[model samples]
Target: MSTIVALSTPPGSGALSVVRLSGTNALKILKRLTSTLDFTPRTATLTKLHHPDSNDLIDEVIVTFFEAPHSLTGEDVVEISCHGSPSVVRQVIDASRNLGATLAGPGEFSLRALSNGKMNLAQAEAIRDLIAARTETAAKQAARQATGELSKRLAEFKTRLLDVIVVLESAVEFVEDDLPPTQTNQIKEWLLFVLSGVGALAESYQSGHLLRDGIQVAITGKPNVGKSSLFNSLMERDRAIVTAVPGTTRDTLSETIDVGGIPVVLTDTAGLRQTTDDVESLGIERAYRALNEADVVLLVVDGSVNADWHEAGLNSFDHKTQVVVNKIDLVQYGHSDLPQGILVSAKTGEGLDDLRAAILGAFRGSAIQADGLLVTNARHHEHLQQAKIEIKEALVALDEHRSEEMILAPLHNALRYLGEITGETTTEAILSQIFATFCIGK
Candidate 1:
């Protein structure tokens, strides 16, 4: 592969910027640009970088060298830390490029790392996730996967599966009648155990993905139902305008907040009702759109007013909808006809904790266990589904007392699908798709 170079840090001026180079020729290019010095392995050396051909001074930079098989990509690599000035970073990169280092495509460094066996595909994807993580919990989850926590768990599952395959293959080699009853039961037990593990891991994807990518929640109700106030309460900031007049919020406003370790994008939508104003109608249309698109809906109602539940659009409820009765302070002495939903006072912040808990509880629901490994990537979920299907097929074959050949095919397929998760049986196309989501220079 050709030598690659790219800015490792965010573009634009800052205190410092990193330009990374990796490949067999990485060290040679670094040597060509810097003054002659002992470029010891795994050491950061302060040096002056010059243009290879022009010999023009580019910048005073710190050069760190990682020798082959010990570096990020398991190949020789060099990182040039220069002043974050755009021109300085560009010159440094152009200098390397002029010296035969090609500009790296997005995620080439991590791709090389996977290609060289330095990290598995799960870890590589985790690197991307970690970079894109929005909340502290998301970052921690991604960091865990990046450090091979998911890989380790998947590896254990794969080992058990391979064990099952070995037993079944042995049975296939021998006649079915010759196989012991105890061994057959053991095979069934192992198959069930492996299936349970895979199913659990697959099930974790919902929470993992929600935590990583977050959920969109639309706050919708009739005019003057305190939807905007609840939005502000959830955000802990006055982001949306609140007024006594109905249809005050003419458009949808959104802000993201961390609720019980899950990122929630709370959208304050215009009141859901028939309107004559064109602008309000447009906003109402958008509100319905947001309502339809949201992962969860916060159906707000006025606790102080005796309004029909149907009139407020809260008659029907779904699993994704949570009813919030706001203005509890005004209704402390009286009870509204609609007795359902969580009661709260968006004015005094009463019941806010319960509201937050309700939002988190509705979506989270023990989908992710504390300190447990989760498979967040869609690709991994798909592969695990495939493996589960194959395991079920093998189990069916076993139950039917079919020939060993019938069971072997599904067992081998199960192994193949499992191997794809750890990148032992992945194709180049899938790898490309996964890595392409990464930023250049990793």
Candidate 2:
């Protein structure tokens, strides 16, 4: 492969920027730029770099070298730390390109690492998850996966499956050499064990997806029901413009907050009320849209007056709807037959904790911590489900004492499906699509 180069650091100016190079000519190009051949592997050397053509000074940089077979890409790798100017970063890349290095495509470094056996397909995806994690819980899960937690779990599943497949294949080869019923029972039992494990992982996709991509929560109510106040109270800051006038907020405003390790995309929308003004009508229309998209809707009501459920923009309440009585300070929340819902004073921060708990309660299992190998990716889930179906088919054939060919075919398919998760059997097209989601320079 040709030597590849790219800016490792983000674009624009900062304290410092990193430029990475990999492949056979990486060290050779670095030597030409610095006009020195004495860069020690794994040691940083501060030197002045010059353009190879003009021999003019480009910039003074700190360079590090990693020899082939032990580097990130299992190839010769060189990194330059230069002043963080877009101009300087671009010039450094151009200087490397002038010496026979080509710019790397998106995720080439990590992809090369996978190609060289440094990490598997699952681990490569974990690196992306770690970079895009929005909450601490999500980050911790990604970190564990990147360190081979999921790979180890999947390896155990594959081992058990192969053992069953080996027994079934042997039975197929020795025609008329009838195996004992005990061995057949053992093989069937082992297949059941593998199927149970795969099913459990498939079931965990809901919590895994919630951790990777958070849920949306929309706060809605009639005019002047302290919806904006409740939003600010939940955020613990004056993010939205709060006013006593009805329809003060003319558009939907959104912000993200962490509640019990779950990322909540909280939206404060305009009041749900009839208005002749065009702008107010548009805002009301958006409020209903937000309501429809929200995973949980908080219906705020005035505690001092009789509640009007119709004006709250709902014919009936679903499981996602939670009633919140605001302005608890303005009226005595006495024990009466009036209805039971969470009462809060958004102006004075009363019952805010319960409100948060209510939101989390809506998503009962979404606040799960990354304890073990919870399958998060949709691709992984799909493969696990397919593998499970094949295992069931194999089990059914074994129970019926049918021809061994019927059982072995599904067993082979199950093993291949499991292998696809770790990239042992993944197609080139799927690999391209996966890596394309990654940013260039990895």
What lDDT tens digits, residue by residue, belong to model 1 across residues 1-442? Answer: 9999999999989999999999999988888998765699988899998988888898998889999999999989999899999999988888888889999998999989989999998898898899888788888999999999988887887888788778767766676355578877888998899899999999988778877878888999999999999898888889999999999999999888987677888999999898789999999999988988887888998888778655756444466888888988888465546558989888899999998888777755656443577777888899999999999999999898887788879988988998898798999998888778889889
What pairs collide in candidate 1? none
Off by over 4 Å in 1: 53-56, 167-177, 241-250, 273-278, 304-309, 312-319, 330-339, 364-368
| Model 2, residue 269: C-alpha shift (Å) | 1.9
lDDT of each: 0.86, 0.87
Error of 2 at 296 (Å): 1.4
Per residue, candidate 2 scores C-alpha lDDT tens digits across 370-425 of 56667778899899999999999998998888888898899889889988888899
Quote the lDDT for 260 in model 2. 75
Best-performing candidate as measured by lDDT:
2
TM-score against native, each model: 0.89, 0.92
Candidate 1: lDDT of 131? 89
Q: Which stretches of candidate 2 lie over 4 Å from their true place?
A: 54-56, 332-339, 365-370
How many backbone overlaps does candidate 1 show? 0
Error of 1 at 291 (Å): 0.7
